[model samples]
Target: MCEEATVSLADVVQEDEQLQEEASAVLAGSDSERCSYPQGYVKRQALYACNTCTPKGGQAAGVCLACSYKCHEGHQLFELYTKRNFRCDCGNGKFADAPCKLFHAKDDVNGLNKYSHNFFGEYCTCRRPYPDPEDQEDDEMIQCVLCEDWLHGRHLGCDVPDHVESWEMICEACMNTHAFLWRYAARLAGKRRENVLRDLTDPPASDPVPGAAVESDAAKETTADETDGATEPSRKRVCPEEAEAKPGCGLEALQNAGAERPGSGAVFWPPGWRSRLCRCDACQASLAAAGLSFLPDESDTVLAYEKKGRSEEGGAPGHDPLMSALDNLSRVQQLEIIHGYNDMKSELKDFLQGFVAEGKVVTSADIRQFFERQQSRKRRRADDRFHCA
Candidate 1:
């Protein structure tokens, strides 16, 4: 769309010229030949002039051309072109052909007080005095410690006292320090809560008693194997003090017991412990060093288990297989939770079909490239629309 409506600059210039000519005629005459007013008389109609005759470049005078009120006394009004001195009997004298001081005075007081109209008194035009500097300083000075912006003292929330021995300003640096300290305190509190939860679920190991005992048949089989070996199977065990001993029988026993345990039946006591520990920095670092990282299947299983646990605690009876599948979800898989298992499965199948059709592997880079292409297409479409319009 076009920003501005069509208009000819020539029309505006013509109107301005007409107004200027009318103003000039009203303010015409040499300074010595200008009209005069009685002492203390004020003008009834305001005087105006073109910018060409004004010192500070204004189009109008504050003083009236018809009467003697000091309308332009303190403002930068356009100079009067009268031959005689057109003095203001309101006591400031003639300012006909001179640059008006009304504008400068207005700037000094910021146009808040009616200095020109009231002459610095309450409805008293005969008086002429400037505002007290001490009052201005006390009322208008306030230093902002943060932005260093000066404001009126009365505008500040904290009012000034009668006497201040030592005023400590809270600078921006100090404010930011306070903010950072609060944020750090909140983070520390969260960590401490997490630690407390962990400690409650998994108490410190008091004494390391060997796990569940091996069955008698397993023991007999081991004994028989040792006896049948030619060199007695080297029954020597590695003690803490031993340097060159064989691996411990206890280590072999533990490994055998772990192998015997049913994978599906294995239960983590406080639940969610594995999820927390697995994602921990220390565990991740250790896994990376061992050349193992989390896989999609493992992540899915973990998420499924977590969801099931939450459901069970929330009063849902028995294990839901759908929730179990959800428990083991990877980060991407969790996004599907919003649509439920059946819907997610359907969506995934459709997505996979599309991938196969395109002979492309869906990846982060592919998604980013697609988004960029779409944005470029939108820009092109917009440009086409604009050009056609």
Candidate 2:
């Protein structure tokens, strides 16, 4: 191999381990041997969409991890990572020719489940397929917590914050739909532009505009500079203090206070922002009415789901399969095996690179053929050495 083409064994091993951990994080919460249909509207699970069964522009459908393995083995599938409140749609009339082998009986449709362009392998406002063949930009995609749609960071209509895993995002479409969320957004939003938001939240004190609204105690305490060197006369307000003491009082105060909503853009909320949501009866009712009762649930976040997956898998970084196989071998056999592995790695990788670069699926037969070719090459080299001797 050329110098540029050569890769370090440690680098290859590290990359392989990283890929295994990522796969485990995604699939740990799922069962590949049994159908999840019996679970009934699972809170969260890894899901797949079969392109062969539910083609683009047709009725969108998603299958659970087990169904993807058992029922749609040879079909082209799109890995959707994870989805919330989803029921597997493997054989429930969506697949014209295929019936789920694992779960034969299922409702015709999961009425509560929602489908999006992502199910059809399209994502972002650009509506491009993930790993797009035409596009070369390797921008990261962020999933909206509300709509569960993946969008490219640049198309999110706002700057994506650093340490993205530390925060959650609600896309612009969801933000507009759930405009009531903006009322609580002041506490969490615009951390990057706190000065701008502060200007809006705390105005400069001028000759008191007659009958100016009383500021809520929930508002940030103003600094001397914020007051512009003039102490405004304290105006008594009924809900100002109560807003902090009562669970839903802040939401109520915002409604009554007629505070202007924040400008349009995606909102990034810090961890535990859910705990800050008002849980009072009226707020709960409003949340339920809007089908967002899950907002207050910390478990609904993708990070939480991935954490659950990791935990279920014993939270191990990974186990080296080759090392495990070598454990029972003698020292001489182990050395021989390691030598064979070193020889196989480069040749096998070069052979597979053609299939990967061409975006072709490598079948079991292809793997078997590669091994047979390697054995043949080894035998020929042995015969040549014997003849020279």
Candidate 3:
């Protein structure tokens, strides 16, 4: 019984394979010798209806076969066993499959050709032939003035509704120049107007009206009062809002005002806790006058003493050291310092050149030793002055 069952299954599978082959042949319209099925019998299974049956008309015809659907036309099949494609005859009407031109026609072009249309009507080409210039429907092309590239008149910012005989095109660069100049001229005009307003608001001091004693006498009295005030003492000018808004302006303004006062010749000192914290030039000078030569512990004190010594020696305070260092630096070294160390290896070459030009042996050790000696001397002098003071 098992052997007979295996043989039966094999026969059934063979029959199914034959049926599938026949169905495929019918669907493909390949069996030219075989007649189509009868009116009552189904020929090819209704995978989809024709394009006329769908709401999208022929637009979605290609997509219809992917849907699992059948026509209710009751299996009336027209004969397809010939070279021509077969049609379905039913209650709806006769519906034919789309023609296969490659197989049936003699000189059919492939859809891949540039001139050929796809299954859809979209044109696919790199270069389409230009239309005649004289044609009424043809679009006029404008050549760019600067670049000489052709563009449609509509694209060139033309106002005309229809194409004209003569069309001109200006490239973007030329357009940008015109726009920039217009804006610059408008800005200059605005600045000129602002200057005129400022001049009108503030007249010069010498422009007094002639034969006007009231104005002249008042001006003289004001000048005399100002001169008398200057002899007495100078007052500090402060804006209340600015003083309040900024952190140290109020205190600085007060100090400046006190310095300018007649009787308050007492020097101002920065506020600090200890007696040794005073670091103004006046304080440092007083310390020096009283036989004090030691450097103060604080940096501010050292700076103050240095500035006082430089000033007394008739040199500009804080200027000589910086200028001397800069003068010693070569042009390339100056550029390297300004540009920073993006390429350190390249900058090191320039640094070495400057180092050799300083009339000293150029070595890493020598450079380090020179700076070390300078720092040691400065520290020793500061310590000695502090002890002596």
Error of 3 at 259 (Å): 99
Q: Write the per-residue lDDT of candidate 2 for residues 200-291, one digit (tens) a residue.
A: 34434421111222232212221222343555454433343443443335466655656455657788876545644666676778889998
Provide the lDDT at 368 for model 3. Answer: 75
Alpha-carbon lDDT of model 1 = 0.32
lDDT per residue for candidate 1 within 1-389, as digits (tens), equals 87754333344445788775444333321111222333122211122332223323222222334322233334433332121112332112223444333221211111211112221111111122123333434453322222222334344333343321112122233234333212212211123222423332232332011221211222232223322233332333223223112232322333443423221210111112122222234434554554334210122222232333334444635556666676677867776563555664675566556765655546667557655865787699789999998
Per-prediction count of colliding residue pairs?
38, 0, 5
Q: Rate the local accuracy (lDDT) of all candidates.
A: 0.32, 0.74, 0.31
Highest TM-score, which number? 2
- Encode model 3's per-residue lDDT on 158-187: one tens digit a residue: 243222221123334343533321221221
TM, every model = 0.15, 0.68, 0.13
Per-candidate RMSD, Å: 37.9, 10.8, 44.5
Angstrom error of the Cα, residue 7, model 3: value is: 7.0
Q: Flag the better candidate by lDDT, 2 or 3.
A: 2
**What is the TM-score (0 to 1) of candidate 3?**
0.13
